[model samples]
Target: MIRFGQLVRVQDGGEYGYAVIGDNQGDYFTENFGAKPAWSPTSKGTVLNPNEVHHRKTVVEDQTITLFIDGQQILSNTMDGLAKGIGAFGFFKDRGMGSVLVDNVKVTKITPERPVDPDNEGVVPVEIKSSDMTVRLDEAFPRVLDYTLTNGKKMQGQPTKIDTIKINNVDIVPEVSLEKVSENSIKYILKAINTENKINADLTILLEVKNNTLEFSVTEIKNNNTSQKTNEEIIRTLEIPNHSLVSVNSSETNANVYGAKISTDTTVNGDTLTEVTDTLRSFNSNYMYAVISNSKLSASMHSNSQYSSGGGANDFVRINPRVKEFESYNSVGLSSSPWIYHRDVMFNEQTLELPEAKVVITEDANDDGVVNWQDGAIAFRDIMYSPVGAESVKDLVAYRIAMNFGSHAQNPFLMTLDGIKKINLHTDTISFTKRLW
Candidate 1:
């Protein structure tokens, strides 16, 4: 897991010692695991500045492994079978804005080498498109439903049965299609329209599924018979399980399965009833859930614990007044961390003292009441703003090292500045002070 400059590795169930690569004060070598520690590790490096390049290398021989930064050894340790076997290496970064880079990486194999097949190099050919285009929800990639648009143009999509919803007193039917685009990805297309009815509009949605996540592009809305466009394309992403299908019961035709009603910037028929999404929900033998994370019936969440709304900043801030505080599901609201960070900073900077409440590095900050984004944001703000003094610098470094789990690139801040706010309604708390608006 990663946050800002920090990188952690738990090899062999952490018996090989958890290694952290980045921190505010600098890189370090320690056997720290589990929670974030408060004090500094004796073996640590200097602070890492953004865009500042540093040469890092690691060598493992027998039971000993050493880490070096800029030609200087920072950490070295010996453990039983620390360098024993082959394992997969992966790089991970948390949400919002953190990254890692590797250049001119050279690996030396001291162990025996295995022979490779020279005949074809054992490389499988990339499958561009799947020819098995049968329409089924349980199949590989299904073209499940078809619909006729307001222009009488028919399109297909992956939903086993297209759901329907009434908007502006017009019945709109949805269409879905899932296609296998490559060996590792599938393409999804969604459309909604009203045929020979009071409403004359078409919504086109395109998405790509890679691994366990879904990447959604901007939705296109064409006002039929008019020279006006209601919705523009925008990029959005969500995480979901592969081999899942959106299913809606035929009985609940008018019931909203996953769609949320949001006011659009564009107007249709002189009415600003344009912005919204068609509902998409997953189906199995046991249960059904929403594919779009921000939907009331959503099944997945972002790394920052925010619902994955498809697009448009307008819909994100609108909080559903019906949902109660303790309700885990069906609560529609924008995440309150980085989105409101600037306001929180200003509010706290004016009303409260810096570090008003105790900020713990691990999980919780402020020692207020609970563990949430407040702690994460506090730690992140220190790194982002660069508080002065040696103790502040050390605290920043310690915070980075402390965030061993459940951290994101954005939306974490110190507790004093962090508080709750409603997204749909405007306030100093939930209002987005940045350019995101």
Candidate 2:
């Protein structure tokens, strides 16, 4: 009879464990979860005696086992039992000179239905409705949006493996604005509101691999053909701090060419080093993504060195997940460069109306450039993000000017966007000033 892994999965032989009693008594949950009276491994784990009561319950105290064979290769200690392994079962007879028997070793794997620590599982999905829906692009922003998941257990963590954030049967054209961000959480305000009473949507906040990513070309993969696939790219995903104040600063850095780079700071949470690419993919670019993985020791990493080590509590940061990184390979669009600003802007669905103005208007605020509809609309948007104050108007105007014109304008006013509301855009300075009636 032939045997395959699927065969076992379909018809398992049932659970099997190991148990032995004598001067030393122990138990193995299954052939895969083996244990011995006086054995240990170099790996890390704890040994559970399950109590000195030979076969009563699982408990133990100060009893320690420095199991060794031929007075060498100390298998494990009381502090490392979980890793003693599934193979090799034995008993320590008088003075560790007893008849010890090992067993038929089997293999086992555990599949978790849920993820841990801010994984996608914690934040369930929900469908948005019409009546409850709101959108914020220009003047109005959705302050609240709710959804229900498969399970109602109170979960909290970062979302993972999201299908999509949809609406009206069509996938939502994801447009996002600056949501309420705090020291420990970042709530991205979506552009659309959900009023859907039925169905659930796993709302995914799209985080692009910043342009500051360690660049990799198609050639990086061993079997991947590079010359034929010039357009192929590898976007690196960022690992955000578990608990920290996530904020973006627009201040550009000279770190590398390719324009402005976003510096994401999670200071509120204890984070030693920022970007950490465990292994370099050896990209075909001039610049290499720095790999400063472990935050354990004071030794240098990014410059060049082997892996840093240490585990458990009181350490810097844990190693990133296994099977990750290489698996998150995605093609990046050029326009998706990283941008760190005071507030994020989302895609607008409709033309926005200008906010009421306080400045003396002769209703003659025509398109001389500064007093037109376009400028007014721009001014209004600036005001929304402005801090409430008399000088805020000027800052609004300044921001509007900056937002409208390229950063290289000499005369800020002439370069700023003023005439917005009055007309449809034809050029950078075109606005309808004829509505002076």
Candidate 3:
């Protein structure tokens, strides 16, 4: 069958039903073929009824395919072989003497279903209902936006000018200043003055909701700057609802960028923390660490080298999801090339977005199917040495052991030697018990 420039083949098998995109050899139809049947034919002889109208329709969105017969759903399957798309289509019997009756065949493009807003359960799409939403900014010049650093340091930034604050292209300011633009989207722009030289530049912040997750992005535009300085810093802060505060799971370091990148210090909930540090030479030699609990999640960034050059900008976007905590931060690096770093933090607890490169935490790192004293020793060895490596390795053997042993712990990297001894005895006990059994 072909529709709207896509091809699909349907084969009819007696008794078993009908199959789509399957081959009929010697003109004899069989149950087994290329593609499965959309709907198994239950007719008396597996033959089309001459008195009744048989209607078939197939809908293809991207690679997903769905088939319908006589207004009744038969089956939906995807096949790459039918990718040639809609073109010439017809029916014919090649082998045994047979005839296929012609009927009215029609093809049309399928209309896309409306997308649901994640934030607002049943609210209309933001782009379609523009007038219902409004965005506003303070009209006052030199507006002060305050922020607190991860290290308990207080800082302030001033917006020298308000470029525009828009919600769905609708100008909303002064009289109806909003605490938030909308549940699903928020966008604002302003010219802010950096604290260092008081230089002015536009700061743009865009918030979008996708896949039941909210993403926040910040960008610094220095196109109007005349300063000869090679590096500079610009900071902008916005207050979101306190209830939206969740765990801080990841932080991305833009090379040559340094200091606490995104911190939830200003929020009512104090547990979330994300930091990134970079200097002229090297940064983030030590991977990030997160302390998670039922109620809150706290994370801190550690760098083997000290921060200096005092430069670069940072942007942090938080979303949802967690997987393989040990393998989360395997990449530790320093690069000379200037790049804007962006890291996605997943918040949805139901989704375990596993990393491509992951280090498994069983004493069975070698996958021998058994845990023994030797495995314990290997874990210790990795704990003492393997925490450093390239950013792209994904799975760092050393960090896996350290995470299992809980070494170089919270705050000042405190080592817990007792964890190793406990694991050692536990492994020994297991091995001895297994031998006896």
Candidate 4:
């Protein structure tokens, strides 16, 4: 079985946040994408920040939920399960702001899976706290969900379904592009593959085509591993040729190395009462990409022992009030790298690890593979999602090494993980294989 995951990242002034890819049962909260704007935390209110995308970034800590925008603590409160296991990090739009981009989201776990090797590849979890967390949660890249936007509009489909834009009857890896069209839209070219075994075409894959979407096939061969066993090898990638299908990009580029991005498009009705997205690259793997717009994302680790909302004695408590609301729009909220990373263990022939049905590599195994609950516990993928903001995007994307992982639900086993490095996309489009990492 192969496990996949990423690191947690904390944004600075850009107003962003994200936890390592894992679970979010204890991690629950909501906020306007970027509405309600106040430079201070609110005990019972929220401010409004006018950004393209507005959503509520709620981090339900063991005892508090602090809202942040542009690295500014706007609102905060105490909650019931504030100090528990954090699972997700993404955006929540009640009805403010408009089309925003959430990007540069990743989740990596430092807390090594129990019984893991002492000398792991990537970083390991130092500790889990609820008050002034001693460990850096920001650098972890933890997430429960992912909403990837190329420029300012939809690049894939919904966060639940990956955009299987096949190029040549093969599954296209992301981060690969076709062309930088008109500087307004960068053609994110994709290629597809077909097979039951490595390079074998045993079935057909379905591709989700949205507005101005196209599907194609691959003409060359460049994949290495068809699957992995340990969590370390689960997220292993197979670089493509010049016509590679996985070379994706963020709306914003840090230095062709690390940063967030949002593809160009006119579908973003953020200026209206609608919020659309294509969380294409969100599931089935440990790696992911997110989009962050003129907004912010954040998270906080409090000490489970003695943590407060900074509101004094009774101020650190949570507020469940019913206030007159306006159009589905609040003010600036908080979140982090909008992403989800999960790990599963299978002695052999895992669910997604092997193959099933649908899009590219789905399947009908001895156990069956469905997304709803009750999918059985046979080493499948974990689900993590979150909201990526300008701040969170700045912390992760382009990191030299990053990864994540999890364990089996019924067995007494643990999975190990490793960090991937030198990952790059072939922006040239003509010869993806020639591109250097």
Identify the candidate with maximal TM-score.
1
Across residues 1-437, which tens digit of lDDT does each residue of candidate 2 receive?
00000111111222112222223222122111223122322222123242322111211111222322223322223532222212222222233433323334333333223223223333323322122121111111211111112232111111223323323233443344443332212233344333332222222232111111111111111112223221111111111221100111112111111111122344442222232232211111111111111111010001110111122221222122111122322111011111111111242313221111111001112335332222323322322223355553443322122232355545345333344432234344432222211
Q: Quote model 4's TM-score.
A: 0.17
Q: Provide the lDDT at 42 for model 4.
A: 21
Candidate 1 lDDT, 1-437, residue by residue in tens:
12332222344443233345444346455342322222224466645666788876666544455667789887776643232344333333434465667667665655423222113232222222112112222222222232222233222223221244333334444455555655534454444454444245443433333322233332343445342222221111111221122221222222122322343555522111111122111111110111122111122212221222333432332111111111111112111111111122223224321110111122234667554333434443432322355344433311111132345424344421242233313443332332210
Best by lDDT: 1
TM-score against native, each model: 0.22, 0.18, 0.21, 0.17
Q: Which regions of candidate 4 are displaced past 4 Å?
A: 1-174, 178-229, 236-345, 353-437
Q: Which ten residues in a row have the lowest lDDT in candidate 1?
A: 353-362
lDDT of 3 by residue, 1-437 (tens): 21011233332331112234223211111122233223232211112333556666656553355656567654554443332223333343322444345567776765444332122223221220122222122223212122222233222112122323322122323221122356545554654443344345454545443321223344333335554233332111121111111122123322111122233355543223223221111112111222211111111111111212212212222211121111232112111111122111222323322111111111243456654323323433322224354443553222214432355344222343455456547656231111100
Q: Of the pair 1 and 3, which is ahead by TM-score?
A: 1
Stretches off by above 4 angstroms in model 3 are 1-183, 194-196, 230-287, 291-437
The TM-score of candidate 1 is 0.22
Worst 10 residues of 2 by lDDT: 1-10
Q: Determine which window of 10 residues in candidate 4 has minimal summed lDDT.
A: 298-307
